[model samples]
Each structure stands twice: as structure tokens, then as C-alpha cells.
Target: MVKDLHGKNIIITGASGGIGEKMARLCAERGANLALVARRTDKLAAMKEELEQRYSIDIYTFSLDVSNMEKVEEVFPLILERFKVIDVLVNNAGYGIFTYAHDADMKEVKSMFDVNVLGLIACTQQVLPKMLATKSGHIINIASQAGKIATPKSSTYSATKHAVLGYSNSLRMEVASQGVYITTVNPGPIETNFFDIADKEGTYVKNVQRYMLKPEYVARKVVDVMLTPTREVNLPRWMNLGSKVFAIAPRLFEWAGRGVFNKK
Candidate 1:
């Protein structure tokens, strides 16, 4: 068994609600201190109030838009000031949309990469130095199953997640000898506000609802991952297997799963 997370400093981005919030609560229960980052201050404050009630832990809130490199640079230092040693960093701030590549909104596409890819990288880079200094730290990246197997109507979103997966895979190996753990999460779908934004058309998320993973399930597993360092996590095991199959026999799988894969 891995050591308890008691007193470990963990920073979670996009932590105002959903999986991020649930993960914070789970980590708090494990006695971990948290730095919750999000663009919404009111939501962050509310979360802090309730989490403190149940767990005696230091909960710091930062209203941040991780996509803004300037803001990230400005605020990350304050985190270091309060929490001298960073133990874990969870890059959970990301979103996706269901739209064909040709019909995709460039604004949304750029924004996705900004937050999903660049933003995740910026946050990881911020704490990376400290982790290197200590030769001990964990970095958890929230990618997606789409990253593993690209599908129609989610081309741009899939590209962003694919970037995350590539980075995590390379980074994990780079820092392994230095004792830093990097874990990438590829979850199929979850019951969260993410669907509201991702599926504005009410298409994909609705159809995939039955196969969706729960926020709490992912949250609990994320916390468990922090305690027990691992390479990667793909939730709802069946979906993970499909990704593997797609990787092994792309043409056959795509031909057989055309409707679901091509649906708009």
C-alpha cells in the first residue's frame, strides 16, 4: 500500500465543480492540503467552506484562467509562497465539443487547445521545477479516451487530448529517474457540466449517456492514484479495451463501428 496523503500539497485546476471538486473532497478526506484553481471565485469559496467542514485541512482558492500564461505565471508563485513544497499537481482544466472538423468554430478550437493543451502544460511546467528540486512529486493529467481513439464530430477536441497524452507519455519517462510520477487519465464520458458545453447540440453526450462514467467514480480513482502512483488510468475498463482494439486494428474497427464513430 502507498503512504497516506496526509499533509501532502496538491493543486487541482478547474476545481470549481464536477470531477475536480469531488477529487478535492476525496483528497481532503485523505488529509491532503489543496490549492483549488478555477475561473469562478464564488464557486471556489463555496467548495472551500464545505470541504473544510468535513476535513481539517488547508484549502486555498485561486480564481485563475489557466489558459492565460501571464496570469498563471503571476499566481503560481503565490502558491509556492503558501505551500512551500508541492506534492502533487492535477491538470484537470479542460473541455471538448462535438462538431465536424470542417464545421468547427475556430474560436472554440483555439480555446480548447489553449486550455486543454497549452494550459495543462503551463501548470505542469510551473510546479515541475519544484518537483525536480525535490526529486519527488506527482503530476496527474486529465486527458480523454478520445485522445486514444479519435472519432468524428470531435476531431479538434480529440487533437487537443491527443496532444496531452503524447506529452504525458514522454514527460512520465523523462522524470521517472528523478522520482516524479506522471499519470494521464483517459475517461470516456462523465455526468457533468462538461456535456453541456461539449454537446451543445444534445447529440453525442446523450447517446453515450448509458456508457458514461460517474464523476465520483473518477474522483475516487484519481485520489487513489495519487496515493498509489501509476502510469495511466482509463476508466470504465470496457471503453479502455475498445481504445486498445482501435489501436490494434484501426480500419476494421472503424468499418464495423461506422455509425457510432461517424454520428453527428
Candidate 2:
């Protein structure tokens, strides 16, 4: 089991807003030093200032786009130099692009993969050696319910998340003996800018807007699972059950999903 956050050095990507921002504050409350990373330097700086003022904990901010692996490699080491050690890495930088298979742009697909799959992989790779050397660390991957089930208009986005699900589990097993822990937090839907950013013309976006979950709710669940060290965590248990069952039996699930999606 992993230790509490007090005095631990933590790194959170996409820390400018949404669940990532909430996680940063929660970690501060637990007395962890944080390195907040995002593309928005102003936002990162503001959050860093607030956390330092309120919690009196060490806080560093970096304006980074995780999709750039080289930049991630360079910035991460600098963060480590500042903090001296990183005990946790939260791979929370991601976006959703909900579009039908044919309607999806290849460029958008690449962007999704770069951020959700490759970026996540690169960050974890950078941190793995340090964690393994010490034989202690925790990696929290923020995925989605779409990771397990392939919804109609969210094909590419779902694919990337699915990759996360498989990759996190495999990484967990590989590092289990070394005392490192990896957990995947799959939340169904969260009331965030996801709908605004997603392809609005897609069927998935239309459907998702109708059943939105709050980012704070999802963030809290993520924190709870991290503290407890669960292998796989899903919020709103019913959605988890329904999605998995749907994954196991696609035809029946598709029929049901269609019924629900088609309702006016």
C-alpha cells in the first residue's frame, strides 16, 4: 500500500482546470508538494499561488503541452530538480473528440492518440524508473466509461481511452512486485467543457450532454480510490455495471443504447 500525501512530491498534468485542478487542491490539503503542468502558464501560476498561500506547501507550475514528448522529458526533470522527488504522477491531461468514424478527422484522431495514449505513456515512462528504483510510487490514470465500451460517435476517443485501460492494467501488473501502484479512474460523464470541445454534430455529444456528471464529483471519487489503492475504479456504480455488461454482450447493449439514444 502507498503512504499518505503529506510531504510527498506530486505531479499533476492538465492542472489548469476541471478534475486536474480539483485534484491539485485536494493534494495540497493533504500536505503534498505539487508540480502543476498545463499549456496555460497564467492559469498554472494562479493556481500555484493560491495553493501556496492557503496550504503553505511547495508548489511549482509549468506551462507544458504533454503531447510533446521531448518537452515533457525536459520539463519533468526540471520539476524533479525543484522538488527533489516525485511520489505520485497523475496523468490527467486529456480531451474528448466525439465524432462518428467516418466524420472524424484524421488529424483530430492523431491529436487524441497523442494526448490520451502517447502522452500518458511518455509521462509514465519518465517517472517509472524513479518509482521502481525506490520501490514505491502511485500512478493515477484518468480514463472514462467510454474506455470500455465503444459508443457510436465517440469511436476515436473511446479507442484512446480503451488503450489507457489496457495499458494501465498491464503496467500495474509489471510494477506490482516493485511496490508501485497504478490505478485507472473511469468516470462515465462529467459536467465539464467536454461537450463544448467534442464534435457537437456527433451522436455521442448529443447523448452525453443529457447525462452529465460534475467534475468535482469525479475528482472526489478519484481521490478516494487513490487513497484506498483500488486497481480499477468507476463512479456512479450503475453506469459501470451497465457499461461492462454492455461490453460483454454488445448486440443486446447496442439495441438498448439505440433505444435510449433515439428517445426524443
Candidate 3:
């Protein structure tokens, strides 16, 4: 049965554009109140205005760089205070710059870890106590298929996602008996501005453009699972199949898919 999101308070991070923005719209359409967080206040303001005009639900916008632990600590409590309770928290603020392992810069590596892994953890920590106390809440972490099936030129990005998957898995088990739920979204490449930074040379996108999932498609899949006990979501079911095979036979999969993996 499809769960009703009406009146639920959902917090979506990195909601200025891409799947995050799309998820915000989907949630709003279903009568879900929204808290949109991103570094782009202007875009968030525009979205807030439009969604408020279209939906009867309340909307809040926060200018946050999750990597900044201080800001994360300050902003999250303010959100909780405004909404009184957070029904769902989507940890989606993340970026990647594909570079060969040897060519990877230390600064970029630290930034990626800080934003993609530590930032996500810090935000989750802030809301977890409340969620556990209330015995109700959902935490969605946006990971990547690269976390499962590592490819060339994305070592650091893949590592960050791997950490997310690991963390989410552990947290899910820890909170299974409680009413709180944890879901990790491991999507393949999607049609979004994400590639503008991850693939500056345009090689990866050019190679995989035909197979990229649409932003709307991914967002809808995510929104559909909201308030449910779904364990994990993997986009492009076919790509997920490949990940399964790779898991069972790493050597064979890596050797056979080397060409596809090196597109970046």
C-alpha cells in the first residue's frame, strides 16, 4: 500500500537542484511540509516561494554547508525547533570530483570525506536522539552504486560512498527494533548537474549519457519509499544486477568490466 505523506515534515538536504530539488517537489505535491537545505539560498528561496504558492503545506529553507560541523550543529536544532518534529531527514548534500588514485589531491580527498561522510554522520547524530525518543523517524542517505562496484578514477568518491553504505547498514541493524528507519539510496549515474563537477572533461557523462537515469525518475522512486520500512533502494535495476554479480565474483567482474569501469 502506498503510504500517505500528507502533513509529514520532511527535511531534504542539497535541495537547490538535481534529485534533491525534485524530491522536494514530489513531497510537496503529496501535501508534505518541507525543510529544504542547501548552500544556495537564492534557489532555495525561489523554490520555497513556488512550492508554498502551489501547496498548502509549510516550507522552510536553510542555507547550510553540511561540511561545516559548526553550522550543521546550529542549523539542525533550529530546524527541529521550527518544525517541532522531523518525520524524515534526507542526507543528500554531497559532491565528487573523479580523479585517478595517484593523481588525487589531498585537499580534495579531505573535502570529499568531510562533506560526503563526516557531514552526513554529524547531521544524522543530531536528529537520531530525537527520532529515537519519539520512536518515529526516517533517515535516508544518498549513496552511490560506485560504492558497491568501484570503478577507475573515482577512488575517493567511491570510498566516501562506501563509508555511507557501511554506516547506514550498521545503523539500520541497531535501530531495527525501534520505530526509526534507515534507508540508503545507491543510484547509478543520473541526469543532473552532478556530472558538471564529477566529470569536468565530460568523458564519463559522454560515455554513459545513454544509460543515465533521469532526475525525476530517481526522485520519484525515493519519494515512493518514504515512511516505509524499505531497507535500501538501487536505481536502474539492471545496473543493480551487475553489482550483485560483482559482489559474488570480484575478479571475474572486474576483469570483464574493466573497459566499462574506465570510462571515467
Candidate 4:
């Protein structure tokens, strides 16, 4: 049976667009009050106004760059002040720049880690204490299928997601006895603006356009599992099969799937 989200305080990072925006809408539809965080304040404000009008739930918008640690520290308290407690935290704020390791720019690489890995950790820490005290809360990290099956040209981005998976796995065990839950979302290529930076040449998107998952589909899958003890949510179950195959026989899988892996 599905859990109830009515009146729950859900915090979604990177809520301006893509799956984040879609998730926000779904949560609001379920009567969940929201705290939307993103760097795009204008888009967030517009969403806030629209959702408030459409749903009878309260909505708060916070302009945040998760990569900025000090700002993360400052903003989370403000969210708590408004909502009193966070029932769910969806750490969906991250980006990637696909490039061969040798050709990768250091600046871009550092920025990716700061936002995708450290930034996620920083945000999780802020709510953990309160969640533990309350013995109830959920932390959802948006990872990638690349974390499970590494591919060419996405070395750094994949590494960050791998870190996310590792961190979430360990954290889940630590909080198992408690009421807190940790969930990681691993999705294949989705039809979103993420490729605007990850694949500027459009080669990857063009290659996988036919198989791309829709944002609404991914968002709905995520929202359905909210407040549940779902360990992981993997989109496009077929891709997840490939990940399992890669894990069991890395050498053979890489040899046979070289062409598919290099699509990026």
C-alpha cells in the first residue's frame, strides 16, 4: 500500500526544472507541503505561486546553490523555521559535464564533486540530527545508472554518483533501526535539459533519444516511493539489468558492450 504524504514537509533541491519540477507538482497534488530549493529563484517563485494557487498546501522557495556549503548551512535553518520539521529531503541538485578523463577540465571536475557529492552530504547532515531525534525522516539521493555501469567520457560524473551510492548504502545501514530512511535513484538517460551541459554536441542524446525516459515517468516513480523504505529506484529496468551484468562480469560486459558504453 502507498503511504500518505498529506501535510508532510518535503524539501526538494534543484526544484526549478526537470524531474525536480515534476516531482514538486506530484507532491503538491498529494497534498504535501513543499520547500523548493534551487539556484533559479525566478523559476522557483513562479512555480511557488502556481502550485500555491492550484493546491491548498503551503509552499516556500529558497534560492540556493547546493555547491555552496556555507549557504547550505544558512538556508536549511530557514527552511526548518518555516516548516518546523522536514519529513522528506530529496537531494536532487547536481549536474555533469561529460568529457574523456584526459581531456576533462579540472575546474569543471571540481565543481561537479562539490555539487554532486559533497554538497549532497552537507545537506543530508543538516537534517540527520533532527530526523534521528524525531526517529522519522527520508533522504532521497538522485544518483545515475552510470554509477552502477561506468561508461566512457563520464568518468568524473560517474565517480560522483558512485560516491553517492556508497554513502547512501552505508548511511542506510546505520539508520536502519531508526525510523529514518535513505533511498537512491539511479536512472538512465532522461529527456531533460541536463544534456544541455552534459552533451553539448548532442551526440549522446541523439544516440539514445529513442530510449530516453520521460521526466514525468521518473518523477512519478520517485514520488510513489516517498516515506517508504525503498532501498533504490532504478528506471528503465532493462538498463538496470545491464548494470547487474556489468557488475558480475566486468571484463566480458565491457568487451561486449564497448559500443553502447561509448555512446557518450
- Candidates 2 and 4 compared by TM-score, better number: 4
Q: Cα RMSD (Å) between model 4 and the true structure? A: 0.6
lDDT of 4: 0.95
Candidate 4 residue spans exceeding 4 A from truth: none
Give each prediction's root-mean-square deviation over alpha carbons: 1.1, 2.2, 0.6, 0.6
TM value for model 4: 0.99
- After superposition, candidate 1 runs with Cα above 4 Å error: none
lDDT of each: 0.91, 0.83, 0.94, 0.95
TM-score of each: 0.97, 0.93, 0.99, 0.99
Between candidates 1 and 4, name the one with more favorable lDDT: 4
The sequence of per-residue lDDT tens digits that candidate 4 reaches over residues 127-169 is 9999999999999999999889889999999999999999999
lDDT (Cα, tens digit) per residue for candidate 2, span 65-89 = 9999899989988987886566889
What is candidate 3's CA lDDT for residue 208? 94
Best by lDDT: 4
Worst 10 residues of 1 by lDDT: 220-229
Q: What is candidate 1's lDDT per residue for 25-132, written digit by digit as tens?
A: 888988999999999999999989988998889999998999999999988999999999999999999998888789988999999999999999999999999999
Error of 3 at 106 (Å): 0.7
